[model samples]
Each structure stands twice: as structure tokens, then as C-alpha cells.
Target: MPLPDIKPGRLSACQYADNFSDAHPPLTHVQALIEAERCYYCFDAPCINACPTGIDIPSFIRRISEDNLRGAAKAILEANVFGGMCARVCPTEVLCEQACVRNTNEDKPVEIGLLQRHATDAYFGSPGAPMFKRAESTGKRVAVVGAGPAGLSCAHRAAMLGHEVTLFESRTKPGGLNEYGLASYKTVDGFAQKEIEWLLSVGGIEIRYGQSLGQQVVLNGLQAQYDAVFLGIGLGGVNALGLASETAPGVGNAIEFIAGLRQAGDYATVPVGRRVVVIGGGMTAVDAAVQSRKLGAQEVTIVYRRDQPRMPASNYEQEWAQHNGVTIRTWSVLKALDTTLGHVQGATFAEVHDINGRLEMTGKHWELAADNVLKAIGQTLLLADPTATTLALRSGRIAVDDEGRTSWEKVWAGGDCSFGGRDLTVEAVEHGKIAAYSIDRALGFARHDTASKRTRPTPA
Candidate 1:
């Protein structure tokens, strides 16, 4: 049966299987051991410092060398409960691997990402051990909106602190972007859900699916009912290309396209165009274009409004998309769409150049025959009701103090919706963790109880 939205691809189902499988498989025990031994084990490991969650790299790798995988996982999860997912998506080349001492000598760094995955997998595969025990009931409750990396981290840490937690997710399935926005190739075998399940297993965290912050539930109600509220609702609205003909058939947002693929049980039925064109210079664009090619699109092209160096996607990821047979055209801006039968058939583009630091078309124009076009430009923040709260805003994002507290007291915000933070999952996790600690401290100080931070280790 043909899917109404998708065109048949050239590859067989088996080929799709190979292409969509995990981008980097976890290291085997021997491989992990060999790689762990390569670590110079610097007293102050730069890899650990590079990590956003700050997991003790040298300590965890040392435990792995000793074949104590559980200990290593505990160390990792202690810092970042979402290390497993981070291992799959983090740009190690820009983060940990780049800081490895070996990179200075041989240009080949220790496989830190794979090593982290191995440790986390070992613990996940084994029987449950109480890595964290819930604190005594604090008679406090926290409400978290959105079940993405940041929301889950905040909820879990809050629960561990003995505060009841309720996570409201707008999506039917929890695990926000992890369950939706990520590339299927990076997250195989439905690992996103598995991580969600593991995180919820910590207890005292209740999840309400299909519950949105502003629709089913209101932010003010949560603030009134719960002792504190954390908002981690990620960017909900896809940024429009400002180009005409966006609503035509065969046109979609890259985030939505990936989300559909992420939720689909069968990739073959996911509609892909024969000639797909993606517009953007970010990871979403690369993901959308590469997945299009993997789904058997004969020709997939990514058009960016700026040069390749200006692309937000990492160089490693850009090269990976190219290797996957996705053509990348930079310094080009989409002008308009050519449609037939009410569906997009091609697109016109203009050569773009910087004029006085502003982008301007140079009048050079061309058109590509595109059966479909995905807009991966980016996303925008959608507040249920902006006027309902006193939340400060900087450039349309929720402005927060250093502690992740918004202008509204007892209400905190983090993740992509909050200003002054990276949108990466790891950074989101950090934001949530920091916010959790801030909330915990505020509550702690009120009761005249001085406990260590909710997530991080006690200071010297």
C-alpha cells in the first residue's frame, strides 16, 4: 500500500533498516577496555570539564577499566541522569573528545561517548540498584511542564529530594524532543522511551500525558497547587520561512517530519519525496535531508542562506549528512515554490551575499525540481498566555535570573524557552538540574534545613 504523503524510495526495507540503525553502536567490553586504557587519566581531566553535566570522566573511565560498569553508570547518572541519550547525540568532537590529551598528539581521542554509553548500558541491562534514595517526604510538590530532557531531569531530581513531582507533557507520549525531534538514525530501537521509563522509575514522579501547560492545565494553577513550578516547555512553533507557498502539499517542517518518523513503526510508510529539498543550516535540516535520502529519496538537497562555516550544525554532522548522499548548497535563499496539482514540484532560489552585514540576494537565480520541501529554519517559543504571568522576556524568550527563576516568584523556567542557554539536550539537562537545585535551596532555606544540593555533590 502506498502512503498518501510519501513517495516510494529506491532502497528495500532492509536497506532502510541498515541506514536508520544507531549511528554509533556502543563499544563492546574489550573495545571499551582498550579505549579506557588509552585515557591518560589526567588528574583534572579536560573531558570531564568539557561535559555540560560534568560527570567525572577520569573516575568513570577508571571504574570501567576495573570492570565496574555499575559504578561508572552511577557516577555518570549522578551528574547527568540522561547520559545515555547524550552519548548518542552529543557533539563529542566539540566537547569531550576535543579536550582529550591524545587529540593533541595523534588527532585520535579516546571514544568518550561510546564509553559513556557502555557504562550506562551495563547498568541498565542489570537488575535495578537504588542509585538514589528519595529524601524524607518534604511535604512539598513540584510541577514540571514538558517531558523533554530538561523537564525529566528536573522532575527526577525533585522526586529524589522527596518532593512529589507531576510532569505534564503536551504530547501523548512523554520524552519531548527525544521522542520526537531527534534523528531516527541517532536513536534506534526506541531508546528514547526506554530512557524515559528508566528516569521515571526513580519514583514520586507522576506523568500526565496529553496535558499541555496552557490548554489542559494552566501555569497559574500549577503555581497555586504545587510548592514550585518548573517550565521546560521547549520551542513549540516552527519558524516560518517567510516564503510563499509554504502551506502547499508536500511541504512540511523538518521537526514535524522527524517527529513523524520517530513515532512511525514502519519507515517505509513514512512519505518521502523523490526529490526532497531542505532549507536551513542547523541539525534539524541535516537530519531531515539525510533521513530523506535514507528513506530512498533519489535526490536530497539542503539549501542554507549562509556559508557552510556559518551553519549551526557541527562540521562532523555536516560531513555525515554529505556522506549519506545529501547535497548541501550554501549561500542560497529560497525565493518561491513551483507547484503542480496543488503540490510542490520545485523551488526557486537566489544567490545570497552579505551586504553591509545584512543578507541580500545577488539576483542570480536557479530552480531545483523538488517533489517536497522541508523547512528546518528553526522554532519559536509558544507561551500559553504571555500576559498571564510577570515573566520577563529578552528577545522573545523567558528571561531568568542566574538561578533560572523568572520574574514570577515560585515559578522557574529553563530549556530552549528560557533565554541565555544553549538549546542542546545536554545544556537543557544542566539548566533543569541547576533550576532544581535553586528551587530546592529556596525551599530548604524556608524550613531552616540545610541539605546538599538536590542533584550535585556536596561542596568541600
Candidate 2:
């Protein structure tokens, strides 16, 4: 039994810089113009219908075609405040671009995501006043918990509607998963922080960091003081692999590893094993495996219990991992970890098959050598004593209506912590936006005509 060989400086400085560079570079002006023109601008665009945030796809593309970059950005930002980040991280291949009409005649769908990045990046790169201004103060205060996409989106919308907002974030910085969970290559050059600063520019929104629910702030206190409360506290609990060797030194949560890589100032100093094994099929698993390879891991493997089609991550993401020299082994369920001196040396997995409609494990088993194992099965809601809030839970998540209203009055929830919809960032933004409007109506404020005018299309 010996300690696992895990240390930093595995990759050279130049390799680190190259490995972590932006995954998709922004398009030039000429390139954007050419791409925008490719859009047929269908009368009833299916692309818009497919988007979770319901951005006006054809209209924005038309604006870009006309050289109206500001208007295009306004169209995108007004629909989803975090459109820029979504453009970078969202799986447009299966969402918007999948529904694109051009995909029929031309195998290539219009680069809607790249065009979006072009427009939004243009606006943020230029010197101009903020897109929206705060309305006359309503004198009513609102307390928002969580600084992730949902919370930030809610805070921005509430502030724009003339409510004073106190955004409470448990973490030291805002942006929630955007700041912490994403792969370093997807969001480069601290874009998450930059977007946060831009979002806070609308005024009337004050951020209080290090304020977590149940500890520094409580639901009862917020209810008593603020006019309303919105909870976007995203899932904070990681699901375990349920193996005895999970406690091995080389085994860790994939989310924690991604967060550590995101926060590291020196990429070369971030320790990574020579051979890494990630277990799960979601984007988090793919991200961890790909980034491990980028960090100079000689071999990286993603083992998913189910078949590839059943994986939560899109096909595009799966292919991206394969292209990055990571291996995908499906229909394999982790059985146990082979550890040496409290360090993971390898993992044993059992073959799985779908019998009728049920998944059953076969007696056949195999093992793969690995110095590190990452568990990315899923995340669970981290509530601070559920009884204290008295909000009804459905399947271990906060139950909310179409308007993002919880069972309890004056308290609302959205994002991954709430039931309904996919856990995509764009979907979370829509939840926050809808919840803010609902909160406004509950407070008896005259609904801003713009709010109704910019309504999102119902999810299909």
C-alpha cells in the first residue's frame, strides 16, 4: 500500500495557459455579419420556441444583420440578463440551434450562440450607459437569498421595477455556479465577475456577501423585515457514490474539484493525478474529465452507469469530451474503489443492462487503474431545517407554481432548489424573472407594461 501520486506542476506554464484558454473565441464584426445573414428569420421561428429563456431569436438576428448591435444586445439582455454567460455555456446544439430551420437544408445550423456572443460582447466591450434604468423607488424592500443566476436575475429585475433589493449570498462572491462550478475553459478571463459587476450597475441593488440562509439570515427575519423573499439557494449537497472507499484520499466530489480549479490563481499549482476516473454522465462529469486531461492527466475516463442516450449531458458535450482525449465508458456502475494507504488506486465496476424497462447489474465486473476518482452523480437541496420554513417540499425540492410561488405566502423559490424544469442556467434565469414579476404583483405595484410585453413563451 502506497500513497497516490497526485501533485501539481504536471503541465508547463504555456500548456496551462493554452489548456485553459477560452473554448469558443468571440466572432469578429465581419464574421458576425456573415453569420447573421445566414438566418432565414422565419416568421414563427422554432429557435425562439426552443430556448428556455424565450429570447426573440429571429428579431435579434435581424438586428445583427442590420448592424444594430446595441438593439440586438438589448433584445438578448432584456430577455435573459445572463445571456452572455448562457451563450458561452448553454448547449445550444440541442436547444436553440437544434430547432433552427437552416439545419434542414444545410447540415450546419446557423451559429446562433456565436452570434449571440458577438452581440452581447459588443455591448459589454463598448462604453455606454446601462441598458435599463431603475424605476422611481417603490419604497418597498425585498430580500433575495443566493447570488447565483436565479438570485441575481431576480435581484436585477426587482431593482429595475423600483424595489430596493438586498441580495444575500452565502459565498464570499456572487455568480453562484457561474462563478464556481463551470469548467475554467468555458468561462475565461474572469467573465463571470465582469458580468456580475455589469448586472449590479442598474442601481437600487445592494449585495451582502457571506450571508447564508439559516445562519446569518433566516426566513422569519426576512419575512418580518422585507416586503417579500425569494429563495434561489441552488443545491449545495453532493450525492455520494455509496462506496466504502469514498473516503479515500484520491476520491473527491467533482464539483469541489471544478470549483478549486476555477478559483486557482496558478493553474500549474492545482494538483491533478496522472490518471483520473470520473463517475457520472452529466455535464459536471464531462467537464471534470476534460479539464483533468487539459491539466496533463495521462489518461481520463468517464464511467456512466446508464447508456449514452440516457445521459443528462447533451450529445455535443459527450462528443466534446471524446475529442479532448477522454474515454467514455457507459453501461458500467461503480462497485467499489481499490485503495492503498487511504488513497484510491483504482475502481471496480459492474456491467449494467436494461432488462425490459429496469436497469439490472450483471455479475461480470472489471477494474481500471486510477490515481483520482471524482463523484458527480448529482446534487441535492441543502435546506437549513425544512420545518423552520414550513414550505412544502415535493420529491425533496421546494414546490413552486408557474409563477415560482412556494406553498407559503410571501416566500418564493426557483432554480435547481425548486421543482419543475431542467437545471440549465437559462431555465434558472427564466424562473427568477417570472418569480420577480409575480412578487411585484403580490406587492400591489402597478405591473410595468414592459414586464408583460416581454413575457417568455411557455415551455413546450
Candidate 3:
């Protein structure tokens, strides 16, 4: 049977709006003070240690306690130019708040993300003052590819050093995945573009839309013309499910699906499914499944080949999905698709078990009556120009040294496409920031080896 007229429901709209609304609303004056007071303000705060950007967490919170919002905002933006977005998207329960000293004694840790958002929002409400300004022009130009978190961070930092930055983005707009890849509800209120506008307001940065890294733009020409180059090109390709699947009406990639939903001004018109099966166990899978259920899917299930412990979605995310009525099925892999009348009708799965460190699909299989199937297994790295360049690789990613310097000198890569990308926007911002510092020092504008300065132990 072919499913018809599946779209977001009114109840789903209500629930999605609630779940995806700004994760942390700006704290009220009293709320910020109370949260700041909870902080011990330790000499060496573990919360700072836990953050990838290493924002002076304690100092900012103390400033908030003192009602110095502008100072707090400056402290944050100094370390992370995208502090507002990070405050909205970062997994605070696992990072900063997890390391709070109060967490050891009291179950409730200070609301660090909220406090940070409160401070940063206050600054963005009026960005004309420009919390930080650039040094004198260095007469050096950098070509930054991709305007995502990493590219934007690198571009902003490079601009701060008085270096000219021309950012190339493939899409019509900026914000990369933050604008397109994220769940729409998480970034409601057009905050992603708003933050990007604010970040660029610092000056020294120029963006050219519809210019891709390799397809439309040439890398060699960029390398020859620019004084330095930062490749924050994110993963552009979506991984296949490896099934003999058809390009039917109901088969889709979770990333593109989520991107469509995020970009849609009218969520009610977005097509959904009556019964949707999302394959994989990562955050993407959970998000797709939960969102499908919210989008009027009568039955939504997540199928993963591995056990729950090996699932990539964090416990908080998994729980959030389950709380929203998403069913999780482990130890199963999508085997084949069932289609009818130019539309997807269902899918087949094989039972799998990890034996001798390898996943094996047993002979046993089952059928699922899914009107739509989404593949959320993972993403693939589409090198903008795969044939022309010979970029080194570490574990199937662009190999980079400590400073995000790729094997090809003068061609630095960061963000998801680069090796060691944790696939989080916050981590990507850190990558771009570090790469900017490294590029600055390499240009002889800075004194020290920026790459050698360790913020934390090398991540394994």
C-alpha cells in the first residue's frame, strides 16, 4: 500500500516547537544572578578545562554575578566568536556543567550554557560597538572555504589579526551545517544567520555565495593568489545505505531531509510518512525518527546494527527521542527495500551480531512495513576536487598536524572534513580558531608556534 498525504501534525507542531525551541532561553537578570551565585568561581575552573574553546567560564560567570553582562559577553566572544550559537547547541550536560564542582555535591550544576547565552545575547542585541577590533592590516589575504562554524571562526580570527579573508560558500547563504544540517526547532528565530551577520560585522571579511571549493572555484588558483588558505570545507557527501535501493518518492537521506525541513518556511507542507524507519543509531537517526513521529508518522522506529552501548547518539538524545515516542531497535541492519507504484512501500532487515570483532548478519531476517525509509548511517567526505589534489589522510580523513596543517603546506584543513573532527559545531569552531592562530604564526605576524601551545592533552 502506498502512503499518502503524510505531513506534520498539529500536535507534532506543538511538541516540536517545544522541544526544538532555543534549548536554553536567555536568562533573566535574576535567573542569571542566581545561576552565577551557584558557581564556586574556583581559581582553576574545571568547567573551563572541559570546554573545547577554553572560554574563561568562571570569570564570565563572576562577571554575570557582578551584573557586568557586556564584560561577560566580551570574555566569551574573545575566546569563541560564535559563543551565542555554541551556547544554544553545545551539549552542556556533558561538557561544562558536567565538570562543575557543585555537581560533585549537588545534583544540580550551575546553568552555564544559559548564563553564557544571556551574556552573549545582550551583546548581539547591539553589535555596532564591536566588542573586539582587528589589529593593523597585515597585508596578508586568506581564502577560507566553507562558511560553517569552523570556516567562520577561522575567518573571524584571521580578520581580527588584520588579515583579509574571503570566504567561499557553495550554498546561497552562509552558516553551513549550522544553518542547514541542524534540526529546525533547535535554531528557531533565525538565530544562525543572525549570529553570522553579527560575526561578520567585525569587518575584514568578505563572503561570495554560490562559489564552491572545487566545482566552481579552483584550489590551485586560490593557493597561488592568496597569501594563506584555510580549508574549512565540511563533509559535503551523504553516505549510502549500501542497499539495492531505488530513488523513489519516499527514500531519502536524513541530512537532506532535515535540511529541507529546516529551510522550509511552512513546516505543514513538508512531506512525511505514515510509517517511517530510520536506519542507524547516531544522533542523526534518533533525530530523524523522533521528527518523523512528530511529523505525523504513525509508527517510527530506529534500527541499528550495533548494540545500544555502541550507538553514537548520546544518552540524553536517545532518552529525548524515546520520551517523544520513538522506538529503538538494536542488532538489526537494513538489507533491502520494497517498493511499489513508484514509491517506497517497506524495507527488509537482517539480524546481526558482533562475532570476533566483526559484525555478521545472520540468516534470519524480518520485514518492516514502512511507508518511508531514511538512511542516517553517516556522512561521506566529498573532497571538492578529488581528482586534482593528493591530500594526505588519517583514518580516511584529511590528515593534519597539531595546528590543523594538512600534509600539503599552505593548505590547512579543519572542520568535519579534516581528521580528528568530533562532528560537533563547537569542536569545529575550535579547529578553525586553532588553524587561524597557526596560519597567523606561520605568516610571521605572531611570535610563537601556535600549534605547539597545548590547550589540553592531544585527543586520542
* The best candidate in terms of lDDT: 2
Model 1 agreement with the true structure over 1-460: per-residue lDDT tens digits: 2222456555788998898988887898999999999998898788887887888898999999999999999989988999889989998888899999999988899999999999998887773767788888888889999899889988988888788998998888888888888999898877888888888888999989889777889877888988999999999988997867889888899998998988888887887888999999899999999989889898999999999988989999899999989999988999889765578888999998998889998989999988889999889888876434566887788887766788887998888888876588887887788788778888873431211222222111
Error of 3 at 183 (Å): 0.9
Q: List the residue pairs that clash in candidate 2.
A: none
TM-score for candidate 3:
0.94
Off by over 4 Å in 3: 1-20, 386-388, 447-450, 455-460
TM-score of each: 0.94, 0.97, 0.94
Taking all chains together, the TM-score of candidate 2 against the true structure is 0.97
Ranking by lDDT: 2, 1, 3
Compared with the true structure, what per-residue lDDT tens digits does model 2 show for residues 1-460? 5668788999889999999999889899999999999999998899997888889989999999999999999999999999999999989998999999899999999999999999999888893976898889999899999999999999999999999999999989999999999999999989999998999999989999999888888888888889999999999999998877798799999999999999999998889999999999999999999999999999999999888898888999999999999999999999989886678899999998999988798889999999999999999998994334577887888988778888877988889899886789998898888888989998998584434543434433
- Backbone clashes in each candidate structure, one number apiece? 1, 0, 1
Error of 2 at 85 (Å): 0.5
Q: Which scores higher on TM-score, 1 or 2? A: 2
